[model samples]
Target chain A: AQTVTQSQPEMSVQEAETVTLSCTYDTSESDYYLFWYKQPPSRQMILVIRQEAYKQQNATENRFSVNFQKAAKSFSLKISDSQLGDAAMYFCAYRSGSNYKLTFGKGTLLTVNP
Target chain B: GAGVSQSPSNKVTEKGKDVELRCDPISGHTALYWYRQSLGQGLEFLIYFQGNSAPDKSGLPSDRFSAERTGGSVSTLTIQRTQQEDSAVYLCASSLRPSGPTEAFFGQGTRLTVV
Candidate 1:
C-alpha cells in the first residue's frame, strides 16, 4: 500500500508572497503520479497540479508548481503570488500507474493573509 | 452532462436510517470512484469501479457500507443503519481510463448529516 504524508498541519503566507507545502510518499512502484488538490470551505475538491514520476521536469500551472523528487520520494507544492483564494485545505495524493485508487495525505490548511 | 454530477447536495437523516447517494459520471468515463471526507480529515477511498471489472470494495470501512455502479456510468453509495460517524461529505470522481496519465474529474459532493 502506498502512503502520502503531509507533515505540516497548517501553513500561512502573506499576500503576494510564496508558500510551499511539503509532501512525501512511500511507493515501491517506479511508475506513479502525484497530485495536489485544493478543497475550499465550500468542500469542492479541485486539482491544483499533477506530476508524473517518469517526468523529471516539475509540473507548473499558472501560480502553482510542484517540486517532484522521485529519487527522494518527495513531492511538494509551491504557490507563488499567493492570494486570498489560495486559502483552503491542500492535500497530497498518490496513484500508482497500475491502479486507479488514489491515496491521500492528512492535508495542510493554507492561509493566505492580506 | 458537462461534468460529474452528484444528487442531493445535502442530506440529513436520522441515525440508524438508510440513505442513498447518487453519482452521475461524465459521459464515456470508464472509471468511477467513491470517497469519504470526514471533518478535518483527508479523503478516504471507499470503492472503485473500472470498466466492466469487479468493483474494489477493500476501502469500505464496514459491512454497512456498499456501493454499486450501473451501466458503467452511474454509481450509488448506500449506507445501511447509518451512524453519526457516517456523517461526512461523500465525493465522486470519474476518469477516462482506469489508470495512467488520465486525470479524474470530481463532483461537488453530497454532504450527509446523520443526526
Candidate 2:
C-alpha cells in the first residue's frame, strides 16, 4: 500500500510571494506518478501539477511546479507569485504503476494573504 | 455536461435509512471514481470503474457501501442502513483513460448527512 504524507496542516503566504508545500510518500514500485490537487471552498477538486517518477526533470506549469526527488520519496509543490485565488486545501497524491487509484495526503490549507 | 456532474448536490437522511448518490461522468470518459471526504478522515478512495470492466471496490469501508456503473457512463453509490458515520461529502471524478498520470475532472460532490 502507498501512503502520502503532508506534514503541514496549514500554511500561509503573502501575495506576490512564493510558497512551498512538502509531501512525502512510501512506495516500493519503481514506476509511479505524483500529483498535487487543489480544492477550494466550492469543494471541487482540481489538478494542479503532476510529475512522473521516471522523469529526472521537475515538472513546471506556469506558477506551479514540483520538486520531485524519487530517491528520497519526496514530491513538493511550489507556487510562485502567489495570489488570493491560490488559497485552498492542497493535497499530495500518489498512484502506483499497476493501479489507477490515487492515495492522497491529509491536505494542507493554504491561506494567501493580501 | 462539460464536467462530471453529481445528482442531489445534498442529501439528508435518517439513520438506518437507505440512500443513493448518482454521478454522471463526462461523455466519452472511460474511467470513473468515487471518493468520500470527511472532516476527520480527509479524502478516502471508495471505488473505481474502468469502462465496462468489474469495478475495484477495495476501498469500500463496509459491506453496506456499494456502487455500480451502467453502460460505462452514469454511476450510483448506494448505502444501506446508513449510519451517522456515513455522513460525508461524496465526490466523483472522471478521466479519459485509466492509466496513471492522467488528469481527472471532479464533480462538486454530493454532501450526505445522516442524522
Candidate 3:
C-alpha cells in the first residue's frame, strides 16, 4: 500500500512571494507518478503539476513546479509568485504506473495574503 | 456531457436510512472512479470502474456500501443503513485509461451529510 504524507497542516505566504508545501510518500514500486491537486473553497480538485519518477527534471507549469526527490521519497510543490487564487487546500497524491488508483495526503491549507 | 456531472450536489439523510448518489462520467471515458473526502480521511479511492466493470472495490469502508455502473456511463453508489461517520464529500472522476498516467477529470462532488 502506498501512502502520501503532507507534514505541514497549514502554510501562509504573501502575495508575489513563493511558497513550498512538503510531501513524502512510501511505496515499493520503482516507477510512479506524483501530483499536486488544489481544492479551493469551491471544492474543485484542480491539477497543479505532475512529475514522473523517471524524469530527472522537475515539472513546471508556469508558477507551479515540483521538487521530486525519488531517492528521498519526497515530492514538494513550489508555488512561485503566489496569488489569492492560490489559496486552497493542496493535496499531494501518488499513483503507480501499474495502477489507476491514487493515494492522497491529508493536505496543507495554503492562505495567500495580499 | 462536456465534463463529469454528479447529481444531488448535497444530500442529507438520517442515520440508518439508505442513500444513493449518482455520477455521470465523461462521454468517451472508459474508466471511472469513486473517492471519499472528509476531514478525517483525506481522499480515499472507493472503487474503480473500467467500462461498467469494477475490478477494484478495495476502498469501500464497509459492507453497507456498494456501487455499480450501467451503459458504460452513469454510476450509482448506494449506502444502506448509513452512519454518522458516512458524512463526507463523495467525488467522482473519469479518465481515458484504466492504468498509467492519464488525467482524471473530477466532478464537483456530492456532499453527503448523514445525521
Candidate 4:
C-alpha cells in the first residue's frame, strides 16, 4: 500500500514571500505520479501541480512548483510570491501507474498573512 | 456535463438510517471514484468503478458502505445503518481511464451528517 505524509499540520507565509510545503511517501511501485491539490474556502479541490516518477525534472505551474526527489521518496510543493488568495488547505497525493486510486496526506493548512 | 456533478449538496440523517449519494461524471469519462473527507483530514478512498466492470471496493471502511455505477456514467454511494463516524463530505471524481496518471475532475461533494 502507498501512503503519503505531510509532516506540517499548519503553515503561514507573508504576502509576496515564498513558502514550501513538505511531503513524503512510501510506495514499492516504481512507476507512479505525485500531485498537490489545494482546497480553498469554497472547498473545491483544485490541482496545483504534478510530477511523474520517471521525470527527473521537477514540475512547475506558474507560481507553484514541486521538488521531487524520487530516491528520497520526497515531493515538496513550493509556492512563490504567495498571496492572500493562496491561503488554503494543501494536500499531497500519490497514485500508482497501474491504479486509479490516489493516496493522500493528512494535509497542511496554509495561511497567507498580509 | 462539463464537469463532475454530485447531488444533495448536504444530507443529514439519523444514526442507523440508510442514505444514498449520487454522482454524475464527465460526459466521456470512463472511470469514477468515491472518497470521503473528514474535517481537517485527508481524503479516504472508498470505491472505484471502471466502465461496466465490478467496482474496486478495497478502500471501503466497512461493509456498511457500498456503491454502484449505472450505464458507465452515473454512480450512487449507499451507506446502510449509517453511524456518526460516517459523517463527512463524500467526494466524487472522474478521469479519462481506469489506470495511469490522468487528471481527475472532482465534484463539489455531498456533505453527509449522521447524527
Off by over 4 Å in 2: none
What TM-score does the predicted chain A of each candidate obtain versus native chain A?
A: 0.99, 0.99, 0.98, 0.99
Rank list by lDDT: 2, 1, 4, 3
RMSD of 2: 0.9
Per-residue alpha-carbon lDDT of candidate 1 for residues A5-108, written as tens digits (9 for 90 to 100): 99999999999999999999999999999999998887768889998899999999999999988889999999999999999999999999988899999999
Q: State which candidate, 2 or 4, has the greater DockQ.
A: 2
Fnat (0 to 1) per candidate: 0.67, 0.77, 0.60, 0.63
**Model 4: lDDT of residue B14:** 100
Query: Model 1, B1-115: lDDT tens per residue?
Result: 9999998899999999999999999999999999999987889999999999999999999999999998888999999999999999999999998888678889999999999
- On the 0 to 100 scale, the lDDT of residue B46 in model 1 is 95
Candidate 4 — which residues are off by over 4 angstroms?
Answer: none
The CAPRI classification for model 3 reads as: medium
lDDT per residue (tens digit) for residues B36-95 in model 4? 999878999999998888889998999998999988889999999999999999999999
Interface RMSDs of the predictions, in order, are 1.0, 1.1, 1.2, 1.0
Candidate 3 residues lying further than 4 Å off, grouped into runs, are none
Candidate RMSDs in Å, in order, are: 1.0, 0.9, 1.0, 1.0
- Look at candidate 2 and give me any clashing residue pairs: none
Candidate 3: tens digits of C-alpha lDDT, residues A1-72: 999999999999999999999999999998898889999987778888888899999999999998989999
* lDDT tens readout by residue for model 3, B1-115: 9888998899999999999999999999999999999874589899989974645888899999999998888999999999999999999999998766678888999999998
How do the residues A27-51 of candidate 4 rate in per-residue lDDT, one tens digit apiece? 9989999999998866678889889
Compared with the true structure, the alpha-carbon lDDT of candidate 2 equals 0.94
Place model 4 in a CAPRI quality band.
medium
